[model samples]
Target: MRRVLALLLLLALPALAADRPPRSGLDYATPGVRAMQADDFANPGMLWVQEGLALWDRPGGMGGTSCASCHGRIEGFAGIAYPRRDPRDPDKLMNLETRIEKCRLDNMGAPPYGYESRELVALTAAVRHQARGRPVAVVEDADAIAAGEKEFRQRRGALDLACAQCHEANAGKKLRDETISEGQTNGFPAYRLRWQGVGSLHRRFQVCNQAVAAEPYPLGSQEYIALEWYLAKRGAGLLVETPAVRQ
Candidate 1:
């Protein structure tokens, strides 16, 4: 019965999407949370933004150079295009965090900030915050996009739910007192009230997997990175809203 229902839900996706186009998760935020997100001072995620700017200028490691040494300050930086196909390794897609890690290790002679660390998340948020208002731009990578879409629709976990069932099919509906969102990634690296701090898109993905009783993938894994790209593509043209506050 459950499987049949899931199949029916899958079949209904076209109609659902046609009726309601994709929208940011912010649309589902409460009035107070929405206000908090709009105000730079009120948003807790700004703390990470500040930290990231500081990290850019703060000298460190054997090279004794800050991120600003190469990329300049965060103030006038353009929006970052990530999950890009690596030039040297075409098969590998490099997300913002991985690129940061590589820069630290190769360019700065510093140890890479492990995934989800405070410093890394702060820097990622800070960079993204600079790109606020610019549309999300992703290069055409057919294979990765297809893989990501498959993952989005694939039912997993003990509950046997796919990401689309909630984020796509029931985006505006309430579930357990919380409104289901489109699971867009534009406002990622944002502050979540539940976390009381900023977090990355991949971290949220892990949380969702766990919520469904599935073993979550490791941070920075190819699977999650591909999904990140797919979400960006799905929400293409949406302005970057890094450090956005979410309930």
Candidate 2:
């Protein structure tokens, strides 16, 4: 069965963790991409940010309340290292996308903006943009961090490669035409040339899972929240680059 084959492939891969501290994907980006990210006008991700800002003011939900009604100006919001334990429900982990959805459902009386939807990505990016240079800092949850670290190391998909293999062990090395980076999460919702649009960290996870022929968990799934929590911890000191451009 495919499961047996995948396990066998996983067993065959090497187990080496990069000893260096975490590095942002920005370091590996091409000059053009870096330039694009640097310039507000040039960054296509800003388009989503614009949309999100407008949406923040527009009335929504059954009550016809806008996000501004409660949260005020989006620019004043501080950056967060999310996928943390939700304050309202300590048992649950909520990322920015989930937080936005929760507000829409519970506060605004609006329908949830499904994961990877343009509106969700825009709002997430807009909020994150406010915290552009802040470092990733969140209260640690040992259980979730450990679970995520395990997920990061485990090999999946038909290729049987673990995330550590490329992002940790072989970072900065060439993988065909492109260089491999240390797979940091400080940047999202980011603009990828391949995607040709802004997308969330979970969207990136799905793409990575699909790349190796593994089944991807649902966006905002607990598994991903845990993985994202681990990644935020791993990239603790890195500054947020919400609209980062990546190859």
Q: All candidates' TM-scores?
A: 0.92, 0.90
lDDT agreement with native, every candidate: 0.88, 0.87
lDDT of 2 by residue, 1-247 (tens): 9999989876655432433567899999889999999999999999999998998998987767899998888877765557777887788888889988998998899998898899999999999988899987766789989989899989999999888778877889999999998889988899999999999999999998998889999999998988998888888789989888998
Q: Over 4 Å off in model 2, which ranges?
A: 1-19
- Model 2 residue 180 lDDT score: 90
lDDT of 1: 0.88
Which residue segments of model 1 deviate by more than 4 Å?
Answer: 1-12, 15-20
lDDT of 1 by residue, 11-116 (tens): 8866768465557778898999999999989989999999988888988867688888877767766555888888888899889999999889988999998889
